[model samples]
Each structure stands twice: as C-alpha cells, then as structure tokens.
Target: MSEQTDTAAVPTPEAEPTSTPAPAPEATEAADVATEVAEVAGAPEAPEAPEAVTEAEAVTEAVTGAVTEPNVWAAPPAPPKDRRGLFAALRWTAAVAVFAAVGTGVAYGITQPERTDIPGLSTKDDGRWTFPVLSRPALPAGAPVPQGPDNKDGTHYAPLTGLLLPAPEGAKADDAVKADKDGVVSADAFLEEYTPEAREKLKQSLEWDGLRQIAGRGWTTADGTRTHVYLLRFHSSGFVDAFKGCDTNARFTGVSALDLDDVWSKAKNTQMNSTTLDFPGAANFDGTDLSVYQEVKPFLGEEQTKIGCLRTGDVLGMVIQTRKGEVAPVTFHQSVILQSQLLS
Candidate 1:
C-alpha cells in the first residue's frame, strides 16, 4: 500500500497540466485512496521524476495550449504577397497594345485617297431634273412585247395613253395640247406645233400614212422650259418608218431650220455621257432608234428649240422642248430617254 501511494504521487506533476480538461471520477477516487494509504502507512511523498517530461512533451503541451485558444491570442498570418504591381503592369501593356492598333487604323484611314478620285465612286449629280420612277406599262393578256420574235411586225399592243411619260415633279400641266380623256388629240391640235403652211402639208401626210392614234402630254417646268411629248402610234412598224412627221425635213413653228444636234453627236462619240454637254445624261437606248435635232443658231425671236424623235416598234415618239433663253440639253435628253423607256 505504501509503495502504491509513492508511485501515484510520482505522476502528479505530469497530470497537473492535464487538469484543464475533465478529470475521471475513478482517477480521483484512486488518488484519494492512495493519499489515505500514504497517511495511514506514514509514507514519504515521492520526488517528482523530472525525466518523465522530456523536451518533446513540454513543446507538445505549449503547442496544444496555443492551438486550443487560437482565436483568443494568436496573431493573424502574414497577408498574401502583394501582386497588384504585376497585375497593374499587365493591364497597362494590354491598354497600350489596343490603343496602338486603333491609332494605326485611324492613321491608315486618314492617308487614303478621296472618294471622287476613285474610279467607280467618281459620280456626282449635275443639274438634271428629278423625274418620277419610270415603269413600262403592262401589256394586254395575249399580246407579245414589241419587236419580240413572236411580234415580228413590232406592234405595241398596250394602250397608247399608258405609254406616255408622266410630267416631272414640279411641272405644271399645259392645257394647250387639248388631249381628250383617252389622251388623244385631233390632227389640228397636233398640227398647231408647225407653221400654218407646214401644218397643211403634215396634215395631208398624216391622213395618208396609216396613223392609228396620237397621244400627247405637255407641261411647263419651273424654269419656263416648255415640254411637249407626243406618241404617234401606227398600224405596224412599216407605217412608223413611212411617216415623215418628226424627220429632219419636218418644220417647227418658229425655228428657221433644224440640224442634227451637235450635243447628241458628242454624246454618241463618248459612248453615253458627253463632258461637252456638262451633265450626266443617258443619251442612248437599246431597241429604239433616235433622230435628235436642235434649231439652228441665230435664234428666231430669241427662243431655242430642241427635238428628239424615237422610233420604237410601231410607235413614233416626238419630244419638243422650247425655252426663251436656251433649252437645256440635259433635261431634253432626260425627257427623250424616259419616253423611249416607256415605248421600248
């Protein structure tokens, strides 16, 4: 019993640190019995075994104490190494690259040529009047297009009135032409464009020529340029060729003589637009033959007149433009082209 008491007291110093945790009741009872046994037997308290607690155990106890109450006293870990400098440098490099690309693009754009210097982009509008969108009139159900393989005689089967070109945007209608609801005017009304003596001759020619109908439209533009477009439809293409109403020998009311338009001759030489005409006018049309004329210089009554004659299929298209000062070639050519499209 005395030996047991001394042995129990030998481990007491090591158990002192473990007292922070809950002590077993059996261990306490055993301790009490060993103390009573020691007092009754009059045994001496054993000296503590210093070697029982080596350096390893002491370190373990300290580490355990620190880990148990970590939040209470442990200093925060050192912050992760700062990387904002490296990240900032990468961002600056990317921004510089992007700006360099954009700047290069702008510099290239600035050094390029002007739009007008380019071949296809070199077009600009020259004083041409704006006409409505021109469309061909619809043909009758069973009729073929004029001059087609099936229509060898080149007969236009559509209504003559629908084939007449409408007036331009700002032009006021001329009431002098006297076209009926069917767009037909009498031979007398058509002859009014010629001198009284020439009218008599043209009227005789029209009466003998198989003239089927005459459809006319007239308008005066804002610039005081008067336009009269007339479609004289014949029985067939043969009759159209035989008619002499719009030919070079035809006489106009006030013009002394008519000659082939020099502007038109220059336009034909350039293939389409003539720089001499000073405007971009499409002066030619396929499937339609043209005989364009202008009144000779040394104006009669200080007025100029220009005429365009189109022979399309079985129809003879006549365009007359008169202005006090001078007739603009561009407007005259535009009117002829628009009229030719409707007949073609």
Candidate 2:
C-alpha cells in the first residue's frame, strides 16, 4: 500500500520530548578569553548567566544558519570614562593659590617703610654731619633751571635764600653774620669779612658792580669750630667773575696772607681717606670751580682761618671756617661740596 507523507502532521515524540530537558549551555571560547583578560587586568567578574546565553545563541545560529543576537550587549564599552573635568578643576585651584600669595606680598611691601630709615636696619655709620634732608625749591612757572639748555646765561631764578644750605643738627647760631629773618644781608654786612681798611673800598665796589643780594648763614659747633657761609648773587655770570672778594689777591681780616691749600689738592688727587684727612665728597666736585686757601703762618690771632671759594653760574660762594688751634680740613671740604651741589 502507498502512504501519502505529511511531515507537519506526523507525531515525532521519539525525536524530541518536552518531559526531558536540554543540557545547560556551555562556556564559549569568547567567554573564556574575556574572563582570563578580566582577571589579569583586575576587572570585576562578569555575570555567568550572560555567558551561557551567548553560547546558546551562537550554537543556534550555527545549526539553523540564521544569525542570533547575544543576550548581553556589553553596556556599549562604558563611554570611555571621561576625566577632562577632574583635570580642569585641579588647574583652577593651583592658579588661585598663586594669585593669593602675590597679593599678600604686595600688601606687605606697601605698608612697610625703607630699611635705611629704620634704627637697627641702617647702614654703617661714617663721620658725617646730621643735616636735614635736602630738596630743591620749586621753580617759577616759566623759569628754567641753571645750566639748562634753555637758560644760556646760567642764571639762577630761584630765591637766593632758598639756595643757601641749612645749618646742620646741634649747631648754635652766630650773631656776627648779620642775616635777617629771610637770610638776607646787606653789602656792608658782607664787607665785614675783609680788613677794616678794605671795607670802605669793597663797599664802593659792591654798589657799582651788579651785586643783587647776599645770603649768609653762620653756626658754631660743640668743638668750638666756627662756620660761616655766604652766597653772593649777581645780575649775571659776568658780574660774578668780576667780584674780587674770593680771588687770589683777596685779603681776609685775620689772615695776613693766603696760600694755596696743598692738602686740598692732594686729597682731591688721591681720594684721601685717612684718620686725619677724610674727604667723602672729593670725587663729586663737578659743575663748579673750587679754590681753597689757608692762613699763612703767624696768624693775626691765636686762631687759624681757612677759606673756600666756589663759583657756580651767577653765584659766588664763600665758606669760612675758623678754629683756635687749626680748622679741620674735612669739615671745610664737606661744606664746600654741599653748597656746590645746591647750586648745581
């Protein structure tokens, strides 16, 4: 008998039975490789059930010749673990710390004074006079300074009294200079520096020459040294040169005759620094002409006299120092240098 075959209707209970279960899926080669790499790299253990599902899917795909997707998607590679934000925060913190330190330093510097002004922080002390701080007076609105390119005649437009050097500290004033409250003296007062016989002639000459004004300052130190400084301002530099009061032929009251101060020339040449002769301003006597003279032997009185003549621009400066035994050269040089600096 020929039977018609219908595969869909036939009962294949012996081929596959529902009461019997299929074996669990085995670990695939890909799962074994992933586990070994994870252990070596210190990664957390993966779920074992997902591995079994992947193996089963792979087997089905091979047997049925159709692609089967894996159960686990591997979480899309975890997005590469972004760390740019953490580095940016660290950099900002470092920048803030640097700025704060700089701000603190600036504040401290603004509040503190100079180290030289402090008592213990001052520099080494030399044998220098304690004089007040020196500052040039303000000029007239349209006037130029002496020796400036605009002022060809080298005229000093500032007040003659303002150009005078102030007395040093701990000095007593002298009444012999005959200076007024404004430090101004008369032609007769300035002529007192010469001998009695010369005063009348000098007075007549001062009135004829273009003598504008005279400013005088005198002080006595604790060591009995008398210092007298006089500033003679003329109408122009030419008149300053014509004044004979400070020339080599000039005659002082107490000094019989004048001789060139060899000590001054030697000190200037050697930049003298000795126990007896110390010249701090020896190298700084520019912008002026200096002539120093000492009293000849057999002085008129028991005291010795020295003269310092400084010609700067339209002014003639005379510094006279007198002492009982001898006038200190150091003090005389200091006075001349300081006066020249003011004129310059």
Candidate 3:
C-alpha cells in the first residue's frame, strides 16, 4: 500500500501546466508572465494635459452652458471630479494677468505732454504778418522803448495828440476790433510795457502838423513845388469807418497799427516859416469855414484807420493820421478831436 501511494504522487510525468501542444519552454515561461501582468489588481490612470481657457471665456462659457442647458439635465455633469481641475483655474488666472499688463502701458503714454525742443516750454513762431495777428504786437523796437514822445525824432514837434492808445485786449475798436490789429505780445508784457498815462498822452499827440503853418492847403519846401495833399477824415459811428472809405458796409480785419504808425510818423527835424495864426481848426477845400467834411473826402478810403487821442477841452473834433510812415501829415480831424477834448 505504501509503495502504490508513492507512485501516485511521484509519477504522471509531472504534467507541466497541461501544455496543449506546448511551445518551447521559454515561450511557455513568457505566457505565464503575460498572464500574471494581465491579472494585476489595479493600475494608475495616465494624467491628462489640461486644456487652457481664459478667465473671461471660461466664465462666459460656464454661464452660457449653465443657462442653455436645462437644470433638469443629468446632475450638471458631475462637477469635474478631477482635483487637477485647479489647473484650469490657474490657466484662467494667467490669461487675465497678461491682458491687464498690456492695457496699463497704453494709458500712461497718452496723458503725458509732448517733449519740446524749445527752451521754455513751447513757443511758436510764424512770421508773415504785414499787419497784426489775432494777438497783439510785441514791444515797440526803436530808440528808447516806451519813449514819451509821439514823433520818431523825439521832440515836442507835434504835441502827441489823437494817437491811438494801444487798446486793451477785447476793447472794441469802433465796433470792428478791440484795437487796430497790433503786434503779438503777451498780456503780461502788454500791461507792463504800456501804461494808461502813456496812452492818454499818446491820445494828446498831433500827427503831420508841426510847429509851422501848413499854408495854402499844401506846404512847400523852399523848392517851389507844392504838395497837393489829399487828406480825408472819417467819423466813427461803427464798423463803417474801419472800411477806410470804400463801401460803408465793407469790413477790415485789422490792418497794421504800428506799421501804419511807421508810415505816418515823421522825424521832428523839418522846420517851416510860420508858427502863427491859430492853425485852421477844420477847413474845407474852399477854405470858407468849411463845416462840410464830405466835399474833400474823396481821398479817404473805406477800411482805413484814423488816428486820434482822448480829447482835451479846447481841441474838439481834432485827430491825427498818417497814410505813409515818417511822411507828411496825412490828415488831422481838428473838429472831432477838438470836440473829443470836450469829453464831459
């Protein structure tokens, strides 16, 4: 009995895995290992790369997806159970940071002042004015600035009278302008350089007429030739006078005040024969009391500027004018200027 039991345990050719038409031993070994691997209890799942989304888009998409989908839908898609979903949040945060940085740079550049090559801030220079600009003229350039004399030569020559005072900016000029278009100067420069008293005195000056008798309607230097002076005086009712003498309705943007002064201001050098007989106040071509200014006024053009000053009592209706610089007296409205002197 013992021998028979031993044979049963030891024999049966040790049937190796009951190999059905068994392959080589090595192949059998490989099959066994493969079967073991397949039977592993659990293997980790591969991590997936997160899809990037911007904050704004993610919010919009989330809202849209929520709103468009029925609340009744399958439990709201299980709330992305992946803990790594925090990666989506990080991606959204990075996208927002990039946009904010770009927007900040543009705003800073726009609010700054442009760089200037000028010494003090920015000063513009455009020189092509035969007359004054919208701005006033700069300081007068000549011998002794702000000279107390009206004459270029600087003397009592013709008592400074009826000369236009530099008008305060915005002060109307016979309804046409504040002043004859003057040069370009700053408001500070104007006030500092020009004084009211100087202007008042300038208003007192007389143009062209000197300390001599302007005789025979035309004055003659020792040379026999006489000057047939055509003087015209204009009255200021309003815009009409600024037209010089053309059309009463004509308009003139300002002509040049100083340049005109240049044209009319004469040297106080010439001397004449007579300083007697109250220089005829206002005269007509006929020289007969001549109350009518219309007869001899053909020479006065519309849009031309008239010169005069604030009047004193004795010089009613009298004004001075110069059509050309440093030339002879063009016109002096004696009556009006003299009348102005009667300012009540």
Name the best candidate (by TM-score). 2
Per-residue lDDT tens digits for candidate 2, residues 139-207, read: 899999887888877788998899888888998998889999999998888888898888887777777
Q: Model 1 Cα displacement at 228 (Å)?
A: 0.1
lDDT of 2: 0.76
lDDT of 1: 0.77
Candidate 3 lands at a TM-score of 0.17
Q: What is the C-alpha lDDT of each candidate?
A: 0.77, 0.76, 0.28
Ranking of all candidate structures by their TM-score, best first = 2, 1, 3
Better of 1 and 2 by TM-score: 2
Regions of model 3 farther than 4 Å from truth: 1-77, 115-344
**Ordered list by lDDT, greatest first:** 1, 2, 3
Query: What are the models' TM-scores?
Result: 0.63, 0.63, 0.17
Location of the lowest summed lDDT over 10 successive residues in candidate 1: 69-78
Task: Report the lDDT of model 1 for residue 270.
Answer: 81
Reference-based lDDT, residue 336, model 1: 84
Residue 303 error, candidate 1, Å: 0.8
Backbone N/Cα/C clashes per model: 0, 0, 52
